[model samples]
Target: MARVAVVTGASSGIGAATAARLAKDGYHVVLAARRVDRLDALAERIGGRAARVDVTDPSSVREFAQGIESCDVLVNSAGGALGADPVATGEPSDWAAMFSVNVLGTLHVVQSLLPQLAAGGGGTVVNITSTAAFVNYEGGAGYSAAKHAQHALTETLRLELCGKPVRVIEIAPGMVRTDEFSLNRFRGDAERAAAVYADVDRPLSAEDVAECVALAVGLPQHVNVDQLVVRPLAQAAQHKVFRGPLFER
Candidate 1:
């Protein structure tokens, strides 16, 4: 029997890639996201199950978890950035949306599925965070604040899961080339979305993040990678930039 793995935010980017990757790694991947069509397409390609789940709603998350008999791996990639303006000028509603999905929504999934995990040997959890956790982004206060909460959750969960079979890991990637990211950041401004990746010499792809996740989950059951920070080569540091002559140097 194939071990089951649950992936949130599975409609696009890292979550989508990780779901497919896990399926290739022999786990029956259960993908949950708001975009049912996209999930259905991906699940079809991977021969998995795609279910509509709104993480922001506790009951929705519960129904998704309830359907799972037993789960071995959980990839929490359901977060995204919202609003990129100084807090003084940023939309408070966007900030609230970020928190609702990134922090509270994560807790909803964790709480609903934890008992299943505990009963099934305490499965591993990989929460997708951001490099923004350790640094600040101007006009990105809301996204950062929500991710900070996730960072805390990762660390706290790790400690709490100690000695148990479960492991909680965090993958903080910088500048991943996922349209879902830029679209969310710019609130569906496609022009702004295109500009974000255009300036960079190279940006991390969704598959790159998924590769790291696959590697982490591939490890021996006794081994645990607490946190993995991945960034594009051009992104030396949070605010630091390396120049390339071809594009917008």
Candidate 2:
């Protein structure tokens, strides 16, 4: 039997890419997400298993964890910026949704699997947060705040789980180029999504983030990567970017 890995948000983007990579790394990847069709297709392509999981629901996560015999790695890559714009114009629903996924969802998965992780003796927990966790943005208030809370949780977990063999690491990616990322940001506004990357020569890709995750996961059980922050070359800072003229034709 292969080492088991539970990956959330595995239908697309970083989650999907990481799931495939981990399977190649000799683990039987179990993917969980809200999108069933996408999950089925991805599972077929990668020869892995899929579960319809809503990370926000404790019952769903509990059952999902129980289904796995022994989970070796838990990747919390199931969050995004939903309606995370200026506070004045943001709706309460959007704020609630962001907190539910970014904060509660992460907690739900961890809480459900803490016993499993502990029972297995040593495992890895990689929380996929964003640069917003350490930085600031005028329109990224809510998103940043939630990531900040996650960052705190990561640190606390690390401290509490010390000497227990569990490695709690946090990867903070910057400007990852993904369809879901832009779509989630713009709520499927293709024009706006295109505009966000119109000028950038290149941005972070899912593979790039997945590579980082693989590196962190492959480390010896004694080695622990506390935190990592990565961004594209063009993205020197979150607010600053390199762009070309829209009509430079």
Candidate 3:
């Protein structure tokens, strides 16, 4: 039987791209997301399965896990930023929501599916964190805090699974330009979202991050990539993104 790979947030963005890549790699991918309509379409295209999963809900995650007989890889990519308000001005609700999905949602899925992952004898857990997990900046306090918590969670899992056959990996990307990430963060402000990547050289695409995921997971089971940080050439750092075109086009 082919290896089984579960990708959450598979309705769009990095999760969707990773699902497609893994499917192309010959794994029987399970595309999990709350958006069943999108999931169905992607699943059919990739010859994978579609699963409705709300990572933030423990019961939902539990139900999803129960349907999986075996899992060789689990990618927790069901996370996003809510707003760009300063710490003092950020909405408490936004912070809570971020924490719920990015941290607790991952926790629920991992806890529920860990047994199946371990049973596979060489399972891999890939957590799609962000550079915000390590660095902080103004107007990003809420998202940064949640990602930091997720980073800590991934690290702790690695330590706890020290002797287990499973490998815990963290992939952090900076300045990825996806269709809905920025628009959702700005609450549907198209111009604001567009301005985020205005005139900058090629920002990292969802496929770029998904490629990193496939590479790490494809490595030998004994090889554990503790963390992989990916950023576009135009982005030197979180605060140091080059706005103008970097190459002659």
Candidate 4:
């Protein structure tokens, strides 16, 4: 039997791309996401299976894990930025939502699947964090805080699972121009989303992030990549985005 790989947030963007790449790599990919319709479509295309999973819900994650008899890899990509309000003006609810999905949700999925990963003989766990994990920007308080928490979790898991058969990894991407990430962060404001990547000649795409995930996970089991930070040449830092006609390079 082929190895089993579970990918959260597999309906679109990085998750979908990673699932497709892993499928091509010969693993029987299992695409899990909240959008059943999209998941089914993607699963059909990749010759994988789809599961309707809401990573934020512990019961849902537990059930999903139980359904899979064997799992060699897990890609925790089921997270998003909720709002861009500054710390002082940020909605507490938005902050809570981000934490629930980005931090706590990752923990829940790891807890549920760690045993399967171990059983499969030194598997890998790839946590999809972001540049916000280690940086701060105005109007990015909520998302940054949540990603920071996730970074902490990823590090702690690596240390705690030291002797175990699991290798914990983190992939942090900067200036990724996905269809939903900025749009959802701006509360569906199309103009605001478009302006986020307006002047950048090239921004990281979902496939770019997926390539990172595939590289990290496809490494020999003895090789563990602790973390990787990916950004477009146009992005030097979280706040250093060059814009406008004169700034374009």
Candidate 5:
């Protein structure tokens, strides 16, 4: 039987890309997300299954878990940034929303699927974090804090799962240019979202980050990658980015 890999946030962006890549790698992928239409489309293309799951809601996660008979790999990718306002002026709602999805959402899914992950005797948990998880930057306090919490969660899970049949991996990417990430962060402001990647020479794409997930999961079960931080060459750090053409167009 093929290994079953469950990818949350599989409706679009990194999640969607990872699902497709994992399918190509011969895993029976389960595409989970709140967007049923998008999930269905991707699921059909990849010959996988589509599941409606709101990772932010514990009840939804529990319900989703009930349907899966076995899960060899679980990719917690159902997360995003809401806004980029400064801390002092940032809306509390936005902060709460970020935490709910980035931190708690991951927690809910992991907790619910842990049994199935461990049952297979060689399971893997891949958390899709971001550079914001490790560093602080202006206009990114809320998202950063949430990611930091998630990073901590992934670390602790690795420790707690020691000797268990599961491997916890963290794949953090920087400057990934995804379709809805920036646009959602700016609340549908297309101009602001487009400007985020303007002039940057090939910011990381969804497939770039997805490849990281596939790599970590494809490794030997006994070999665990504690954390993998990926960033485009143009972005040296959270606050440093080269906004010029560095490659041939």
Candidate 6:
């Protein structure tokens, strides 16, 4: 029997790419996301399964987990930044939403599926965080704070599960230019989203991050990659990005 891999946020972006990659790697992929249409389409394309999952809703996640007989891997990718407002003027609702999904959502999913993971002898849990988890910047207070909390959760989970068969891992990507990430962050401002990658020319792609996830999870069961940080060559750090001709210099 093929090992089952459950991936959240699989409707698009890194989540979708990771599902595809894992499918190609011979695992039975269960694509989970809020959009049924996209999930159905991707499941058809990859010969996988789709489940409508809203990670923030515990009952919804519990129902989703109940359907799975076993899970060898759980990829928590159902997270995104809501707004880029400064702390002084940031909307409380936006911060709350971000925390609910990026932080609480991860916690809920991990708790719900942990038993399934353990049932299969050992499994891997991959948390898709951002460089913001470690680096603070202007206008990124809310999103960064939520990711930092997620990072902390990942670490604590690792420590708590030290003797268990499960492995906890985190993948932090920088400057990934996905279709909806920036647009959603800027609240549908096309021009602003476009400008976020205008000069970089070669920002990280969803597939790039997916490849990293695959690499870490594909390792031997006895080996665990605690954390993996990935970034485009143009991005040296959170506040540093090379643009235009200067990028190559």
Best by lDDT: 3
Sort by TM-score, top down from the best: 3, 5, 6, 4, 1, 2
**Model 5: per-residue Cα lDDT over 103-222, one tens digit each:** 999999999999999998789999999999989999999999999999999999999989898999999999999989999999999999999999999999999999999998999999
Candidate 5 vs. truth: CA RMSD?
0.8
TM-score each candidate.
0.95, 0.94, 0.99, 0.96, 0.98, 0.98
lDDT of 3 by residue, 1-249 (tens): 999999999999999999999999999999999999999999999999999999999999999999999999999999999999998789999999999999999999999999999997789999999999999999999999999999999999999999999999999999999999999999999999999999889999999999999999999999999999999999999899988878887
lDDT of 4 by residue, 44-125 (tens): 9999999999889999999999998889999999899987877878899999999999998999999999989998667899
Residue 60 C-alpha lDDT in model 2: 91
For all candidates in order, the CA lDDT equals 0.89, 0.87, 0.97, 0.92, 0.95, 0.95
Candidate with the larger TM-score of 4 and 5:
5
Candidate 1: residue pairs that collide: 85-139
Model 6 stretches with alpha carbons more than 4 Å out: 245-249
lDDT of 1 by residue, 111-229 (tens): 99887777775588889999988788787788888999999988998898787888888999988888678897887899988877776787889999999999998898778998999
lDDT of 6 by residue, 115-194 (tens): 99988779999999999999999999999999999999999999999889999999999999999999999989999999
For model 1, the superposed segments whose C-alpha errors exceed 4 Å read 245-249
**Selected candidate, larger TM-score, 2 vs 4:** 4
Pairs that clash in candidate 4: 122-165
Instruction: Please tell me which model should have the higher lDDT, number 2 or number 4.
Output: 4
User: What lDDT is obtained when candidate 5 is compared to the true structure?
Assistant: 0.95
Better of 1 and 2 by lDDT: 1
Instruction: List where candidate 4 sits over 4 angstroms from the true fold.
Output: 244-249
True lDDT of residue 140, candidate 6 = 97
Best TM-score among the predictions, by candidate number: 3
lDDT of 6: 0.95
